[model samples]
Target: MPTPTPSPDELLVFTGSYTPDTGGNGAGLAAVRFAPKTGSLTDEPRVSPVPVSGASFLAAHPSLDVIYSTNESDTGAVSAVVRQDEEVLSPLGAPVSSGGANPCHLTVHPDGHWLLTANYGSDTMPGSVAVHRLDTDGRICELTDVAVHEGTGPVAGRQESSHAHQVLVTPDGRFVLATDLGADAVFTYRLDTGTGRLQRIAVNRTRPGSGPRHLAFAPDGAYAWSADELSSTLTCHRYDPDTGTLAEVSRVPATTVPDVANQPGGIVASPCGRFVWVTNRGADTVAAFRVTGTSLQPIGEVPSGGIWPRGLALVAGHLLVANQHSGTLAVLRVLPTGALSRPAPAAHVPSVVCTLAL
Candidate 1:
């Protein structure tokens, strides 16, 4: 059922949450409007106050209208926004300091001159990836390099150390993947863009409890996709894009529901990269895969119109989902064979996890 109206190609979403001083109830940064022939998101949404406390995650600036976030707390920050027009988004200076602690994912370096972050380190600290140097007008011009990230796994109270969540940036920009939910690992780096430094190269392990949280790159850059989040699996890599390295091959079961209590919480890839979608968060569901020819073809799992589906975004051929603990904002309808239809809501966003379309 298409045509719910609104679409001159209308699409602009930047929602990221967990803001009421971090107990979450997000009212800090939000603004939705996507409508690709009504795939949904505009019944009016915009909780934005633009304060930036725990702005969970967002990144956009391939050529600058700018917008970057991840100010996740316990003392972590990073911001740079701009787009004060079709519904405001201000703030472009006054956020720095994210060299460590909870910065949960970020990326922007397709020559926009580096801004990567993925701190997630608390519980006595370990994970880190900082590096930020961007000023052609995109703001943020300091924090030049951190890179910590030791190790630990087997998942006790969530792997005990090195928790770096996500920080990918490899669509041929020459590698900088980070994901390390307490070290099930996936650390290839090498972005010394004249000194913002990263330079790790390759670690890529996966499988002993597999907490690897988010890392999806398959636009034809050969293949890569992981959302392992503490064993609610889905691995399948082989990518090498001129030696950034991944090579795991296959794993599956990102929530087909058997013993329940899953956790994948987000993984996306489909700009016709032949499909991949995952978001299991305790099995609230949203799975679907089919990268065939290099493995992965489970295409099954549904229901994620709400509840815990952290975030998954694929715009313009739908599949928006950001259901954090059921605070809505679903969309799902990308089935011309990639399969995923059966999500509906489109806005209710209370503590919505993350989504960025621009």
Candidate 2:
């Protein structure tokens, strides 16, 4: 049977942000209704106005109405909320320590039993991935385990220690992958469901000082890509689900804007698998790439419509951008050939870091 189409306002997208307490201008968790047909937002409101300090990133439960977020701060934490439809969200439980400082990303395990986070450690601590168990009622539970990484890259200040920027579960749900920006490597782990623990299985190193930050899998699940934050490049990997390994294959420049220094922010593969879109923070542009099997071809670049395009997500044939510095939400058309339309504000949101489409 064919799946029924979603209505214009049926898609509930939430914005994770940085509040004034974190030196950012966001008030709290906000919600907006996105209209896919016109690539615009219908209305902007504080649907879930809970004050989660530095809620910089968000993820949804795979099979529940719960939402998870990373409180990105010096003393990092994570929280859960029960999303009651589009307008109301109630706290599922109190926020808990993330076992490390400055957690920037998280993902719900495929089995719905675990929530994994990547803690970007502070000056004194090392970055690590923490595992937490969730209750059947979707409540965020206590920390069960943490795997701290060690080693550093060549970059003096930025690479002084391990900083796990993002944690992700493989498409096959067999292995967990983490992009450590300070270590210049992607670490793979296996989660023991019964014990709620993470075991390090593999470490795929990128270019010596690449500073790998985020990982996006190809739609086909045959390849993976990483936004090399420090080196301003994209590294391709051949993903092996059986052995749970990512073998580095190729590299490409992440920025097309001329002369300006660049740091790639968000990187996501299009749902169709033929394209990849990335945001260039310094250049404030979106770079497009055509994926042909194992290699990616540079297509073109488009302005992100606001300053500091920190993150992006592709939904309903559009690229939703959270322009952190400009305090705005921008929408861009994702063309068939892997290009994007001009950046236009769908809403003005302060200190927005990411947009999670539900």
Identify the candidate with maximal lDDT.
Answer: 2
Model 1 Cα lDDT, one tens digit per residue, 28-48: 577778767767677375434
Model 2 pairs in collision: none
lDDT of 2 at 167: 93
Give Cα distance to truth, residue 99, candidate 1, Å: 3.5
lDDT of 2 by residue, 1-358 (tens): 0112236445667888899999898966777778787777744463747788898899988788888989888888999988776567887888999999999999998888999999999999999999999999778788899999997999998999999999998988889999999998899899999999998998987888899989899977889999999999988999988888888899899986779888999999988888888999999998999997688899999988889898899888899888899988889998877788897665888889998887
Per-candidate Cα lDDT values, in order, are 0.81, 0.87
* TM match of model 1 to true structure: 0.34
